[model samples]
Target: MIRVAVFNFKMLPTRAFDRFSLQIAISGMSNQTDDEEVHVGPDGTFRPTPQQAEDLQLQLDEVEQELHQAAKYGLYLVEKNEELWQTIERLHVEHETAQTEWKGEMKTVERHLYAAQQERDAWRLCVIPLSLRIPLSSRKCHAVEDEVFQLQQSLTAAAAAQITMQMHRRGSELRRSPSSDFVGSRSVILQSPPSLDIDLDVLKQAVDDKDAQLRQALAREVDKDAYIKRLQQTKRDTLDIIQQMKTAAAMDVDVRRSMEARHAALVDRLSAVQMKLDESQDALQTRLEEESRLRDRIEDLQAELRSQGDDVDAQTSAIQSMRHKCARLEKELQAVSELAEAASTSATATDAFDRLESFFNLTALGIILEHQHRIAQEQLLEGSSRQTIARWFREAVASEVPYHAWHAWLTQRITGKPRRRFFAKGADVSPSSSLAKAIADFFDKYRHDKKSPKRSLESANPTPPYS
Candidate 1:
């Protein structure tokens, strides 16, 4: 209740007359007795006694002090309210400035995003057409796409570098002429024109250099062709030697000596080729190292450009567009290089495979010849007759050794046939021969007699089992 009364009192208007009236009323109430009687004056009108007048004066003084304090408080509150309004206005202005800056940044970001999307769509269009036109395997297609992505990265990095360099140069120029007219700066840019012309000249120069390099590479490829022809000749010679060795496996002269000599010559040629290949590899490594150094420098420039500010984004994008075209050309060049490398690798692999096949043929021929030679030696040691040997070889050839009973049949033929003999009875016979014949005849007659008795006994008691 007290708080409500205080609030209501604070709500009252701060007027001097109202404060005086309130003071008068308070003085009257304080002077009044419990019966509500009042002092009377001589003229019969109401008047204040000395105590009442003193009390009223004191109340008026207190009211005046309170009014003065309220007036100071109101003045302070007014100043504070004005300060708050000023603060509100300042905050509103800051918010608007911030919003404007944010909007500008968002617009810039949106433009960049839109441009990136467009570039992505353009790349897809290019790749889709290329992929559709070519009849490449999936692996090759993926490789092509990877190469494109790498080229894009390289081009973007190069563009970024070019933009960064240009921006630095522009900043320096601007700094040099802080008070130069805008028209004057524009005139200067038109006069020098550092961007496209310079890039074109550089590209042309690079193309000329690449043309020279390609010519050199072509010369190297010609040398490789010569080497490949030599290898082919060697292979043909080796095959011929193998055929000769097969035909004359049992010849008196040794064929391995000629083969060994040819193998040594092939090894020498291969060693030379290997040396050449190593030299080429070393050159490639050096070139790649140089390229890596250049790439590193480009990255450093890009990093510096990134540090400069956000203002170069549009210029960077324009540079990238130009570089994308350049990168397409680079892609074709890289494809050519890759094709050449692949051809070289395939040729090498083919050569190796051919050499390996030839070696295997030679090895198999040697094994067969050695086995035949060992068999001949064993037969000679066993003192096999010439006729027997001839028969064994004839039978081995006739058997054809396939489909059935090769081992058993060959073994039976290799063991000589059993011998049969006949004697002439009219010719004069030696005494010993006659005596042996008589003894043989007597034994034969005795054996016949013994068999007759046994036959009679069997006939008389024909076995019960037989019956």
Candidate 2:
């Protein structure tokens, strides 16, 4: 039975179970010493007495059962650890896939937005009211009007010249040929007839033809006057239409301005929504970092288990800690999902964001203030005179420097970024009102204190006085 137990113990795969079996054998042997002595065989081979053998066999059976149980438990832990690793890997892969999908979705959305913007611009151009598109220059209409006026003047002049010429010719013909009454009177006065003879009928026929010519000239003048009046009326109508178009164009300008304002508002809202999405992405990144930390912790636990498999309590505690971490991770994941959903739905979901922002703001403010305090202490420790330190702090508090200038100055001091040759200034460059206010409050608290002392003095410490 002893040989069989030894063989079974040796055949066990794990060192942990082997150690456990050795511990069991040592305890059983110790119990035998308290109970009775083992009998030795004559051939120099040791043999246990009957009671010792039975006790030894029973102990071996117990040890084997324990070894088997330990092996099974170890296998279970290994499998669990593997499952955890697989879960972590799966989660990591899912995170990467989600990020890729989100990026693709964002790109697609941006493309669609760009296309929509272009389409909107195209529609704005294409669907513009005619009033807005009305030609500003009336050169063509002016040229037509000028040509019509010139043509009317030329026709009127021609008609007048023809009438004048006809009148002149009639007057000359009447003068050359005397009237019938005048001829008769002249013949009576002369007693004898003159050598030249004048026919009265022929003179009357010439007078009638002249009268018909004058009538035709008057008709042509009347026709020209009527045509001129019609052209003038047409010109007046065109002028009225142009005036109405100009008024409509002015109204269209106002409408276009309003539409542009609305478009600008929409663009601002879109930018706000994009900012929200960026915040959610930041949250996701934080979750990934947490997951990485958890993975590292699990790997540490696994190493611990390999090195000290006997420490079951430590393993249980590590597993419990992992469970707690996993729960936390789950909660974080849920929060990230909520953030993303809110960001997608509305830009107005600022209440929750404001709370988060406030928390981070306070944390950052505390860090900055602490850093500045440490720097001040170091300066004092470096033997800077108390008056000089006080003067520097006073000067900083009194200066009217803008937040952006302060930010740039700090950035240069901390990161060694180079400045431009000429300082670029803008009104809307910086709006970290919270940080600025925090800084201002910090300064205001101790600015009035004139007692200059060393860094060792608690009261002289240049620290944030806020709770």
Best by TM-score: 2
Clashes of each: 0, 0
In model 1, how large is the Cα lDDT of residue 391? 46
Clashes of 1: 0
User: Candidate 1 lDDT, tens digit per residue, 1-467?
Assistant: 00001224345555755444444444446434475545676876554556655665685568669878998999999999999999999999999999999999999999999999998885565444333333343454456456555655665678668777876897788778757566788677677657656865665565556556556655665665576566557668978999898779846245677778899999999999999899768745543453344344334433543554554563454334323423433343344345435555334333222222222222222222222222344432232332343343344334443212322333233322211111232333222222223323433443353343322222222211111
Candidate 1, residue 157: Cα displacement in angstroms equals 64
Score candidate 2 by lDDT. Answer: 0.49
Per residue, candidate 2 scores C-alpha lDDT tens digits across 39-59 of 666976456577755666677
Off by over 4 Å in 1: 1-31, 34-44, 127-467
- For candidate 2, list the clashing residue pairs, or say none: none
The alpha-carbon RMSD values of the candidates against the true structure, listed in the order shown, are: 51.5, 39.4
Cα RMSD for candidate 1? 51.5
- TM-score, prediction 1: 0.23
